[model samples]
Target: MAQIGLFSSAFFTLLAIIFCFIFRRQAWIALLCSSLLTLGLFMPVSFGVLLVGTTITYFLGNKSQNSSKIGVGIGILLGALVSYKLREIWMDSRSLSLDDFWNEDKPWQIIGLSFFVFNAISYLMDIKRGYIKSTDSIFKLAAYLLYFPTLYAGPLHRFNYLNEQFDQAKITKKSFNNGMRLILWGLFKNFVVAQRLNQLQIELRQSDIGGWWTLLIGFIFFFYLYFSFSSFVDFFQGVSEIFNVRLKDNFHKRVYLSRNRHEFWRGWHITLNEWFRDYFFYWQMKFKFWRDKPYILLLLTYLLIGIWHGITVKFFIWGFLNACWILLEKRWKIPERMEKNNSYKFLEIGYHLLICSLLALVFIFPSLEGLFIRIGKPNFLPMDVFLFQKRNVVIILAMCFMVDQYHRWSKDLRMDAYFESLPSWKRRLLYLPLILSIIFFGVFMKGMDNYYLKF
Candidate 1:
């Protein structure tokens, strides 16, 4: 339950710098130290699940080629997931009807168990497929599972990628500069942009607002999610880059340019979606029945995605609806060509934004009854009402939009390369605004955890 606050981020950043210097040639030692430090920050209960899972996987990985052992590993992993996530349902279905069975105090559930388990499972699968060479070093395996940067919220890295990177990591001038830029940029987005929206979200939750306001709030929540989650990913990537690990870029550069749900999914929460796609979707596709009816795999992929968030009804609904939406998009074969025109592109963007905002309502409302109530009843309220009331939030939203647009534009121009091409003094000067932004706007924003940390 302990969230990664601002102070923790600073501590980790400083520690990463120190680790880079001290364990320059031994990244495994740095990772081990970081894992321990991160464990110390959170409840011991949280680390319990991680420790058990990592231990089990490390052992299972040695004999991963054995089908029975692989089954046992998968079973143990799935059992842990079901016992922890569906504890209430499991209890409810019991004949004894022990209402307090789940109430007994245990170690706090792991904060990033969902993501970490995926990493472990992927590692085992890789080993099973002979994709990962057997290594006797527990530290290397531990580092893969317990890597602190992505521990709180991952664009979960594959074990093979991380392992490969560990062997190749080295501190370099370019990585240092780029990492600094990403860190400052991430700080600004999280603290300045997302924090403001978070305040609005809190207010909206407390208020009795409904109708159009719900949709408005949904849009705010949607953007807030992007800002918060992407910020953490950015920071994580930057930290990893500093260590020369260079984790995969989780978010696509042209996420906003997505014209369809499929493209959107490819960009957003990318690592999680990719994990489901690669493991579940692809595996299911091999079955004769599912091969023709690919939508079944699609639906199940999203369902698991939902369940991965938690066993909540909302998460289930969110996953299922999105699954359906994507299937419909595929069935219709939505034209990528129509989005070529400037006007059409803007229209498409607006349409997608509206759809995303409305769909996001599923996350807010637990049941269909309440969701229906909001949709069935529309207050023909002017946009001015909400805009005027939450003027500060509107301004922040505008700032976010502008920043995102700039990001999109910069990517098209290969801004990173351009920055690197600059002279040394000019490159240092570029850091000034980023540093100032983090210092000024981000200074007062403390203890505001990223939204995905809860998942």
Candidate 2:
């Protein structure tokens, strides 16, 4: 493959300046600036592919003027996700490294391209259905496709939701404050909390284990990972809202607190959940003929979701497992006994925790990532990860969940007339500490990679 030349930061900045002038809009500039930020950070091949994939999808969606063709194009594109993503796997099978592109055999460097493809295909599908009207400009579509913030690991937003953020409403003082707060919050969650937990996760993953107690400890580590990750989502959403560019949020404060599988899916990675529902499940439910075939529909939709995560056996099983739970819930609803009985609540929580931990292990052991190996892998005392969960890690994990719990009951922003009712001096004192915390911790913690960068 030919090497794509890098564009300087100034180029994107200039693009931002020109668009800002023409559109008279801050969001347009903010999003274009996002792409510029990405070009600088991401490798050239990755960024090049993303720009091409997104812009092409947008243009085709606009010109085709037919939903069915768009759907087929999207299906073919989604199918290509595996082919592009699994270059390393194909090379491994052949026992040869080919210089197909870049000449460097970096297996782990797919760079979230598959995820972007998914977004593109979904956009095309939406356009076909008239959910998304096509964009006229290549630049704006480029901004939507390669906007760096959501690109690394996405809430996987749909074009319908994305186009809605093209609001011409003034970027109010409130939006600015909220955006800054969100970006700062994202930094704290990603660099501080998530990276810290990953250290423990790496160690525990490498070790061996056995017994219910060790398994319990393993589950605790997994919990920290979720906390660290979900925190990243909240932080970025806040940042996007600052630019008046709203992306879907994956973490819901409601889901973890949910008592059943149906509600849990509602709260988890909400965009993908909704994507599967809309593209696959919703239409079937709308048609009378397909009511009896709910199981097959459920099976296929979730299987696609699982495979989208990666082309691994474990990922497929993960999807299947989730599908079964959802189907069981669909067929029998959350049993009234399970819902009301206080004793079952603990079991339910444990079940949720177990499912989450096991799902996470798919990423933990990618090479041995199939059903049999996942079951057989050493999970033991001296060999097990919890044989050594550190003190600092335990403390950080505590803080991670403590924050999530706080948000469970708290809003990110609140302007009670009561806060205005407070004495000025008292309000100042309260705001002082928060301001200091954000500056001291957030500003200094921009050190590690965002977990989603690997796609």
What would the TM-score be for candidate 1 when compared with the true structure? 0.87
What is the overall TM-score of model 2 with all chains considered together? Answer: 0.77
| TM, every model | 0.87, 0.77
Please state the error at residue 2 of candidate 2 in Å.
Answer: 26
* Model 1 agreement with the true structure over 1-455: per-residue lDDT tens digits: 22344556567667766786788887667766866685766546667768878888878777557467876887798788766777545554684232243222434446677777788888777777777765687778888888877776586888878878878776788877777666666777777788777777656655656677678767878878888888788776776677677766677766755767877887888788888877778867888999998877789889988877668677888889888888888777764555445567777777788888888888766466887776666554444445654766555866676576657546643334446666879877766755665566552534544767646
lDDT of each: 0.71, 0.59
Error of 1 at 42 (Å): 3.6
Off by over 4 Å in 1: 1-4, 19-21, 87-107, 337-343, 376-391, 412-418, 421-433, 443-446
Best by TM-score: 1
Clash count for candidate 1 is 0
Tell me the lDDT of candidate 2: 0.59
Off by over 4 Å in 2: 1-30, 33-37, 67-72, 91-110, 169-172, 211-218, 284-289, 335-338, 341-344, 367-389, 411-446
